[model samples]
Target: MTRAARPGAAATRPGFVWALPAAVFFLMFALTPLLLVVVLSFTSWDGIGEPRFNGLDNWTALLHDPVMIQSVWTTLLLTALGVVTQTPVSILLGVWAAGHQRNRAVLSAVYFVPLLLSATAVSVVWRAVLDPNFGVPAQLTWLFGDGNLLGSKGGAIGVLTFVGVWQFTPLHALIYQGGARAIPQVLYQAAAVDGAGRVRQFLHVTLPQLRNTIITSVILMVVGGLTTFDTVLILTQGGPGTDTTVTAYYMYQKAFKGFDFGVGSAIALVLVVVATLISLAVVRLSGYDRMRGTAEGL
Candidate 1:
């Protein structure tokens, strides 16, 4: 015969009961605000009195706004640069660190230093360092006798891309390093027995094992690129004629500076949709969904 249930045992049993507090917190903080944003996006509010219902007006404006379109293109460009530059560098560094323990500490310290600095601090330091007259960049560009990196369109994008890559690649490297180390040593041994060299082993064994991690890293970096504003705002103020103005900063300007919260909310929601689509594309392109059941079957 089963023992009689203790008082409140059913309520205290192993289940989502323990998650109630966190679920409550998420509902109160996250879900509520998100719902409010969605509601507000459909209304016309100027951070003042009444929020009049104005359906799709802000979204319609976004479709034709040249500045919004430019900001979107800029955001995509930065994200593409981050993916292209950071992913390979991170994988290479992670592989190097995982394979060789001798300099791992030094490498990790060097790579992670930028991440420790606040974005504003980093931007301020870089701004000083890139000063056209007296900065290191000036000295370097003295070879060609043309300096002014922060002034030109291509140069502004390049600096923003460099900063994005510099700050983010270390996190991706840590992800890859963890993934590399988690791989079974027996697999490497078997690959070696089959005449696989280091490069071939990496290509065949390491990369396949780290595929999910890489996909996760790509999604994170892409999202980061889409939402990046603090560094660009602090450094360039989206200056040199909006060359570095990403959608995030544009949203901020519309919301705070221009006092157009409805438009900003629409832009924020659009960014959310765009980010979701891009993340799904990354997952599909990396074949993450296809790899799901194979591991369980194995």
Candidate 2:
């Protein structure tokens, strides 16, 4: 005999049949290319003749390369910075925008314009704005010193990190905004009845409700930060020395510029492995993978 379904519970969770198409597509596209890259990583090829198997040469080279190590650290540092800077701001803006206030509609429209611009466009605009000749630093020399924001290591990294935060924060904000809107209003009303103030409501009611959303947003941010490419290519070009030579750009240089496809493939494979491991760790530690119910209604 069938048991009666409980009210407010998910009536019909998506089954494996619903996911078959995407699974097939992923296997055909993503997994196929990944396997090809794995094979290429084990071979020496310059994009000319047939690739010759080189075994552990490509792997061992990157293991001992000082620049490679530094690039890994830089990638991790930028990713960490992005999470730290973007999370709170995104949450605040998102929660605010989730309100019924009229100003929110107007402000959100203007605030979301940055996401319309491509990474290349963002980089170019920022580069012009920071130009030593006539950019903000030039006009405000006393404030900006020499106006060479991309000339030095710290300045270059700062610009890159800021640009990343600026361009990507809106997207994360949208995610949080949606998550906030999805929360049951009864919870907030009950909290209000309990004499919970605005700050208390947010801290206790909103944040806990958005836990899964936060996990999702953070996973996206980590992946985006790890694989940031176009901005680095267009803005800094991994220049002013290798100060900004992140792993992605370094792979580009090795593969395209240096004409060492083998090494580049090896680096790319390693990046994929590292990103996967870190994402799994986040899911595991957050207990997102072990839970069964949704984040709301608590």
Candidate 3:
């Protein structure tokens, strides 16, 4: 007769069997490409040719590259503007919609419509809206007479930021709405009993409760803004003199247009590092681990 398996054997078996496949898949698909990119960053390669090892030459060149530097700055600016502009609006709309349960479905659907459209579609629509000569701006100019909104730096950045905010606020609003729903109504009732007004209740109860969701939404928006390419490419193509070329777009131009694969890889690697660091920093700052701990405690 066979001996009975030990108590911990079953638990170990599943993990051991699963671990090998998961590790193999990760190494083959994920880690291997990352390693190749890291290796390529140190080599000079045109798209069709073999790469020649050049040590840190690509990175060194990137450091002195004006366009790359501007792209990085623009990306950071866009991310900052996106978060600042979108977060409060999303939270306010979410809280309002959640509070007004009667109109929650209609309002949520209205806000989420933009997110359903592809970036290309949104960019095309907005391009016409912002066009100075024959679009909505022109119509407005006819009423108000001759102002080129898309031509000016401030106006251009404002339009980009506005588009980013409009497209993403709905996503965050939905996330926040879910978070708001999860909040126990008894807390609101208690706050009301203590003579707290709507704004006070939101500050004291809703904001703190929805902190984790807000953190997550902000992280998503920031990353999207940082790496944004399609909408900017369609709308501005880093136009008005490189005002809107984000790091991702810059890398695309470097790899494709300039045909500097090695330098492009280095820039892409820097973007990955930046995104990873920002995500980690946000999670830590927002006390994401604390939420995990609470869930574990429960």
Candidate 4:
């Protein structure tokens, strides 16, 4: 009996040993880089040179930087617009798609095409569309009158917002569609028997069931909006006079263009902190933790 028990314990030891490899991999690949960035955020370093400890100077400079302030404001604005625009559109599209099972695959594919495209590709496409002279806007201006959409601050930001929505709507739509499809047909049948109209059914049944999915999608879009860099960089280049520069772009400029790694790292740290806080706030407001079980059903 003792010898048989010893063999079983030896077999179990391999599983414990396998867990060690995963822990070691995570420490080496993930934790180490994060810790290095945190350390670098408090020190000054030119790319080619060794980092030197600078204490709070980097943080202090960040507080005083006008560009940094502007970047933060722009990031907030984009995030707000994304949440407001993307959530409902995705929900509506998702509801519609879920109802049309025969067409779901084709519609999902069409909607997801933009998402499959690279950031560089999106930028190039939009750049051509927004070109001041020979682009789609120019043709539209010829038909309308003096409507230089990308030439003005509001218009530029609006275009950026629209592009962001277009790119991300498919992702949100898929999320919502999955949620909507998971809802039992019995609920819809009961709602119909009670003479509930489309709007009321959506409001009372669909929306409540989708609360968790909406929260998750909104959080993802908010973080993406706040950290948007590639699209803005390619489309407006923070142009029309720094009107479109989000915090990510500012971080890039500071670190790469201005050779200020410490300040750049500080900005990156701020972005991480802000995104985390906002996500937590959304989860709390939406009662996502409480609804975790229901959401799993969807």
lDDT of candidates 1 onward, in order: 0.85, 0.91, 0.84, 0.85
Model 2 agreement with the true structure over 9-86: per-residue lDDT tens digits: 675767799999999999999999999999999999999999999999999999999989999998998899889999
lDDT of 3 by residue, 1-298 (tens): 5989899887667656668988999999999988888998999999787899999999989899888898899899989999999999999888777766657778677878998998899989998877777777677866525656556667778888999888888888888888888888888898999999998999998898887888889889878987888877887888778777789988898889989889889988999999999988998887786665212222
At residue 292, give the lDDT of candidate 2. Answer: 44
Per-residue lDDT for 101-202 in model 1, tens only? Answer: 667867776877877888888888888887877887667874525667778888888888888777787888888888888887888898999999999999
Clashes of 1: 0
Best by TM-score: 2
2 or 3: which has the higher TM-score?
2
Candidate 3 lDDT trough over 10 residues, lowest sum: 289-298
| Per-residue C-alpha lDDT of model 4 across residues 1-298, encoded as one tens digit per residue | 1455664686667666778989999999988877887898999998888999999999999999888899899899988998899898989988888876667778777878987988889878987877767877667876535657667788888888889888889889989989999888778788999999999999988998887778889889988888899988888888778888789998898899989898889998999899889988988887886766554543
TM-score of candidate 4 to 2 decimals: 0.89
Tell me which of candidates 1 and 3 scores higher on TM-score.
Answer: 3
Per-residue lDDT value at 34 in model 4: 76
Question: What is the alpha-carbon lDDT of model 1 when measured against the actual structure?
Answer: 0.85
Local distance difference test, candidate 3: 0.84
Descending-TM-score candidate ranking: 2, 3, 4, 1
Worst 10 residues of 2 by lDDT: 289-298
**TM-scores, one per candidate:** 0.89, 0.91, 0.90, 0.89
Q: In model 1, what are the clashing residue pairs, if there are any?
A: none
Give stretches of model 2 more than 4 Å off: 1-24, 292-298
**Residue pairs with backbone overlap in model 2:** none
